[model samples]
Target chain A: MNIGTRSFQFHTPAVIIDQHTIAGPLEKQGNLTAEIDQFIPDLYDDEKTYELCYTKLIRQTVNILMSRHPLTTYLFTGDLINQSTPTHYGLMETLLVPVTFDHACATFGLSLQSAAFMLQQGQKQTVMVGTMSHFAAVEKQFRFPNEYGQQKPPSSQTTVTGGGFCILATEGEGPKITYATLGRVINAGFKDPYNMGEAMAPACFDTLLCHFQDCQVTPADYDYIITGDLGAVGQAILFDLLVHEGYQVNREQLIDAGCEIFKDHQPVMSGGSGAGCLSLFLLSHGIKHLFKQSLKVLVIATGALHSPVALLQTPIIPTIAHLVVIES
Target chain B: MNNKLFHTVAEKHNPPRPLLKNCVMSFIFGGVICAFGQCISLFYLYFFDFSEETVGDPTVATLILITMLLTGFGVYDKIAQIAGAGTMVPVTGFGNAVIASAIEHKSEGYVLGVGGNIFKLAGSVILFGVFASFVIALIKLILT
Candidate 1:
């Protein structure tokens, strides 16, 4: 089936598949699943809610794809673990059989490259590449700056709860993956342990613009361009620079998943900084409608490549973004 | 005989100077500050027909302007000395200091001389507030 020619249909009112359902099947495999279960107890209601929300998003994507196409395998990009949490990785592994996880150096381009390599090796007919993130857990784990009495202006209220999934099926008559490119990662490697905004801004901009160049498309080529978690200030800076470059991208198209999911206008401090911000959006919103309508979509997921060592040393960490093109 | 002597001694005492002064000034200055805020609110309502919520903009602007003028006249320093934290804690105090300092050095170049030094004291405070919050967040992220 040609995804490009045929109209894509989406299942209405998405449902989250609970860990209990996935766990039951995984339990038959080995003790690793049990070890993962210990970290996340079903007792905490919020934990259950997070899992349920993400599960529902994943289930919706799978249901939609299975109904539309004749495919067996699916692929997930990177950052399956929101904050390197074992529970998150375990949950993600259950959904996609052949999963690839990489470190900060593996740009989005490299990660997607690896996913393509996995598909080639397995000779899978259809692959669903999806990602989910519950930033609430990551936020709770790492209290964001806004929680510490910083007054955030009212305009910072865009962060909303996020979850999204995209299925990449083998070249059929359906939607085609026109081009996938990853920008080079740039870091001044300066040490500014206190405010990451100063350090991250430069790295994020250089790589993001570079990815646009690699794709050989101006920012105006696509109807809409979506960025991962470049919080408020970063978003402002990126928009300013883009406008200066003669590309007029609407602020709405530059969606910051971290800010969107946050609900409250609380100073997300250095804005939204996490992997989950982008993943959740892609899983929940990125693919569903665009494929059905056959609208061209460009997705750029940005990440701050910081290790515990870099953070403690107060060094400005570098950032990288992966750009993917979906055409129907 | 002992009880009568003790009663006479007790009657001869006077109140502490600082304590009495503070109590008296608090009533006078506190009333003045509150009245100013009320007057600003009323003005906004009368001219703009602003609701209570809408009055905040004008009230804040008025307070800022009044504070700035007072700072220039050096009256705000006296108020601060008398009221201590009471004067500084309100939004008006911050507005006064910001504008007063900016205008005081207006003769200096805008970017380098005046603008650079205008936020000197306030800049540190804002930066401190921002950093303190970031640290607290870092701690929470680590421990959690």
Candidate 2:
């Protein structure tokens, strides 16, 4: 049922039955390394190109999720690659009808919401929601070459090198996605692509505000309200915005997926990002915590919707965020 | 909040770029690269029959060759990151910009990928370089 202008409360919540995650060498040394299911020691993964390696990552994630829940009737997946080709190519042999989405880093929440909506309609029995990103592939497409030596600011985020997928069914014994709040495209007149945290923080805040109003719950109600790929810089900006909006935000409860991936020692500047960043965190760490405790969590995935071509033409980097409330 | 007000808040959170540090690093590294080029120029001058003016061609060629090798080895960019515009202001940076794009687009194929994208970044540099030189040449001719 529609809760607000952009919010929806599912009659039948979609349950995440099982999840699998894969990480590359750098991520293997991260704080959530123990939670990751598969580890690829090399970024190349013996593939000729970075795109091919990303395709392999998508294929592996889908295959693992399907193996666990073979009854998966639909696939919702996306990535940061051009036209999301890695996702399409990766799922080519799966023989499942795939709906590819592109919301940059916010793809995780979009896919999850779609899966939940499909399940709510009682049309699809099981849906596989997945997202993956490769540092090399994404860098080549969006920024610079893997070997191109360019100094990045402290606000810049390193793209995570792996991805995650989960099997969501109408009836399952796991955390249930109950609410979704879709964010409007927000441009805060910030033009620095290097400082993506600032560019995307406003969108996250916009979505969170809508979510709080639509659900008629405060930030104190949820065990956690996690933002996707916001990193340290973005997280700080978000907290400031929350305070500005007169919302009482618990610092501990409001965490970020980007901040959770890498340890403080890692030289990832602000933190890890990409479509995989949030998915990896949710699948590897967040979902597990849901089963351990009767927790109510909100996952807000923020995406920078500007392309290199558009970035050069315009000064503003528009962003969007999608919020999903999962309860156990 | 309005975009203007929100921007102020966002900007406050974003740490300012370390301008002084970047300048110092760029100066030192750029000087080192130039000194190395001078050493290569002296080597050519000492052993070859070329004069001072002609010696520049071989010295530049040698620097570009070295840059190509370093870029292929994936080490130049690492150095450039610390050096900032130090590596980019020189001819070696130009070589890297071309070769790096070529290496990155190699996946598409030799003709459409590598060949087409070889000048993806450097094409602007070449165009502007020629245009500026032409403008200067015309000015010099008129003055003469």
Best by lDDT: 2
Judge candidate 2 at residue A140 and give its lDDT: 88
Each prediction's DockQ against the real complex? 0.01, 0.71
Cα lDDT of model 1 by residue, B1-144, tens digit: 122322222223211136556656656765677788999899888888799888988888778777777777657755665664456656765665566556544545688756776774467678998999999999999999
TM-score, chain A only, candidate 2, equals 0.98
Model 2 chain A is weakest, by summed lDDT over 10 consecutive residues, at A284-293
Q: Scored by Cα lDDT, where does model 1 land?
A: 0.48
Q: Estimate how well candidate 1 is docked, as a DockQ score.
A: 0.01
Once superposed on the true structure, which residue ranges of model 2 sit more than 4 Å away at CA? A289-291
Candidate 2 residues A32-51, lDDT tens each? Answer: 87789999979899999999
Task: Sort candidate 1 into its docking category.
Answer: incorrect
Just chain B of model 1: what TM-score?
A: 0.62
Each candidate: RMSD: 23.6, 1.4
